[model samples]
Target: MRDLLGRPADTATLSVTDVDAVLGEVAATTGSGSASRRSELLSDLLSRATAGEQDFLLRLLTGELRQGALEGVMIEAIASATDVPADLVRRAVMFSGDLATTAAAAAAGGQEALLAFGLELGRPVRPMLASPADSLDQAVDGIAEPIVEYKMDGARIQVHRDGDEVHVYTRTLREITRHAAELADLVRGLPCTSVVLDGETLALTDDGRPRPFQETMARFGSTREEQVRALLLRPYFFDCLHLDGTDLLDVPLRSRREALHRVAGEHVIPGEMAPADAAALLESSLDAGHEGVMVKDPDTPYAAGRRGRAWLKVKPSHTLDLVVLAAEWGHGRRTGYLSNLHLGARDPDGGEPIMVGKTFKGLTDELLAWQTRRFPELERGSDDWTVHLRPELVVEIELDGAQTSTRYPGGVALRFARVVRYRPDKDPAEADTIEDVRAMLRG
Candidate 1:
């Protein structure tokens, strides 16, 4: 930033037009031999910028502008400004996959324009997400008619097929059709001429057990055909959003399941319609080396981009009594507290605690205030961002599982770890050992 600032130019103010011009020039130099020219343009813009303008420009360039205008807020704003219903605007955004386009439609043609934004071929729609359930019983009981399916620990994929031309997208709507040619071929071979499917895909072992998540991610990230062929991804589709010429987004889960079964056939994920069968499916999913089951309400429509009670994910979490080795200062709402904790496992050989993972989840405001006051009292040393503790404070952590990691001395790290509660009654010596953490990876 210092180098970019260089020397200030004699400019009173910088306009949006000036910044847009510089950005346009930078983007235009993408295919040309203009490295020095692009740098010169950026430097000039920075030199002409005021302190506030420079900060805004840097944040915009780095995609860190944290203005409170989230999607929901924007949707409401668009509806109020255009005199359209907020629900209509939100649905348009979800189907169109772009807020700007939805806003333009609302402004240009109002309700009629927004209503026309239906599911489009080759365009990905936002995925429906599930809320975390405490237990299978709770998930089953909460729904009127529950449909249980295995929740695979893999990358979420949205596949669209328009005849032989198939497109595959990640959960974020980024198209990876070229990299996932095999997936495209698989979708193309389906019976439907035009279809949209949402599912999870992962690599499998020789015995058909799912591979580690990292291995599945490697294939998704790679463009090499050899690597993609070697670690072929197997997709287990759970929902069919559009089948043939009909859109199923507004349809109930039961009807959607029928469409999915007819189209995806054997690729349809194993599921049962009865709430009584949820327990058996969960046990079978776990025994098959998969994650727990997703309990879904069979009567609810597919609510894209919503984490409502229509779908609930239940996983058998593993808890471990771990030690807090250090903590970093929080940000935003937790600004003054030592929010993020560096967790460690006890070493059985009388050595220092082995650093495993860190977490800031499940901490209530009361706990945050208590940690801010208590962690400093046990502080042995300090740094700019973290306060090192004396390894005497034991915290109970609940996690999904453990994965192999090279970042820590223990060679394993906790996954989806959150604070269950502080084990103030337990001693650090009685904490879980590093060997016990490694056993999760082996299991």
Candidate 2:
């Protein structure tokens, strides 16, 4: 707590990262101890802290919420305060399900006990790889490994059922079983004693295709339950994990696809096992006016936690790696300062960067300050709160995932594209080509 707020004399010198590290180490130390003892310690600590502090502690301890509270920062703070190597702290975390146990175990037992946590809750917890670049070339290169691609829709869900009981988890592994009771009844009819299936839940358009991601997100927060009911969400199964008591994640994509196709039927968003030509698929998708397809390696097993080259999504044309040049003030939590951004990209033919659009959706409070501090250094100048900058950073953006507009230069504008993340490593010259933007406009 002292470290988080930097309460004491010397602690004030500690940076934000230093504070994060201190908290993580405490969590890891407790994780390395007896489970009961660690739990009690966590309970006590949690009780004394305000609800906000508890949330911060949870974010610090768990490896989640990395934008501000990164693992490196957390490790540094803990190591400095507890005098432990950051690596040991990381190893301890991988061993224990929770930080309290991880801290205690690292402090008490060695890696031998830590390595025994291969199977968690009778289901294994593996390092999940992130999805590779959502580009055609990337998908084609992965074809040697038998790739299959599906629609990159909104929600990724995992459904687990043992007899009458059922549990549904979101992509982040949060239990959201209560949020979608309709899905439970749908899963009940499946032909298995116990099963785990991985798929996406999407809001469908009136014509039966999946609706835009915006509609899907908005449906979740609607206070009118009737409105939510009116918005139909169907599960499009792409992979099968557990059939009966057998875990299919180890099975090859072909075997899993066969099993998934057989059981999931129309519910499964079909992906061909054949590694078809990427350009052909891209053309078909663009013509259909739908988001791009996901290319998956047919031989690859279900990578539970990993996003790797095993799967690649090919999005529709008309996206860019634009730099955030300026921002406007926000309301509510962000009362003043740049909350929204005016994005820019390198000149289409080479000159000055043209204004792309503005977005306020992706940034969090902590991220806002981080940007507020960092952007000024890059800032070329400012008109108002909309500060202009030298085009340096690039962001991977997505639209409806294809839409046309005539509001901007280039004789076109983006439909509903928004920031995914800032690509610091990518050079501005490498921002999306104008040809790609034209392809997007065709739709």
Candidate 3:
């Protein structure tokens, strides 16, 4: 923008239509002719844009445009604009997997158009989500018959197969079929002619133990055949949304499990229906090197894109008292607060606290305010983003587990670490040592 518009003080002359046309041309330009054509289109766009327009374009292109409107707000706006129920629009967006498409459908034909959206083969539908539960008993307290399944700590996958052609997508609906050809081939070998299955995929060791989360994620980043073969991912499907030609979006859990069992066979995740021993199942899952268990209501329909109480995830969290080394300045709603704590484990050899990991989760408004005021008092030095503080404060941190990491001096990092509370009674010398944190990897 600076190259083309160079200190132009002229009033804004570009309209939305003008910018949209250039963007359309840029989107359509492809193959060997794309670079020069896209450059020309961008040059033309900047020539007509004012300084303010150029600034807006830059932010929009770079995804730094931070208006206050979120997805929920946009759903409400769409409902109001189309004179349709918010629930209907949200459901449509969930199934269609595109908010813009849902809004256009609602505008074109109202409720009828929104209702027309269904589970389409080859098009990814938003996967259902589970809410966190403190314990297994609490998760199944009100439910009559709970279906508990092992919750794998891996990447979420939504696989769709239409005859021989198969496609796999991530939880965010990004197509990864090229990188997941082995998974696609396995889907093609399923008994059904066509299906949509929701599951998790992860790399495993020779003994079938799941690898670290980072190793599983590394398989998704490369397309080299040798690399893909070196770290093969195995799929463990838990839900069957579409089987053969019938759509099971509105099917109950019991019926969906039957379908999943019929088509998935050995690929199905291990679970028991209305287990008399839910706690035993959870223990077995953890013992098998899996995450935890997902307790689900048997009668509830699969509600995609919604984190309702129909499904609840229970995992035993491990907590440790660690020293606070530093903190980073917060952003957005936490603009002035000192958030994102730099957690460190005490060195048994009496050296400086060894950095393990950092976290900003589980902090309330009161905690944020207290940290902002308190950290500055103990600050030893400062940088543009981080405030280095004296290792005088100890905080209790809850984590899922620890993994081997080369990023920190401790050689291990916390996974899903969150603040439990500040340990005012514990001295820094009494904090959990780096050896204690690394012990999680052994188990």
lDDT of 3 by residue, 253-347 (tens): 89999999999999999898889999999999999899899998889888765558888999987999999999999865677889999999999
In candidate 1, residue 364 scores what lDDT?
A: 93
Cα deviation of 269, candidate 3, in Å: 0.4
Error of 3 at 67 (Å): 5.5
Q: What is the lDDT of residue 102 in candidate 1?
A: 94
Could you arrange the candidates by lDDT from highest to lowest? 3, 1, 2
TM-score per candidate, in order? 0.86, 0.58, 0.87
How many collisions per candidate?
0, 38, 0
CA shift of 69, model 1, Å = 5.4
Q: How does candidate 2 score on lDDT?
A: 0.62
The models' CA-based lDDT, in order, is 0.88, 0.62, 0.89
lDDT of 1 by residue, 144-253 (tens): 67899998888999999988889999999999887777789899999989999999998988889988887887886797777877898899999999999999999888
Candidate 1 residue runs with Cα over 4 Å from true position = 6-57, 65-70, 77-83, 104-109, 223-226, 332-337
lDDT of prediction 1: 0.88
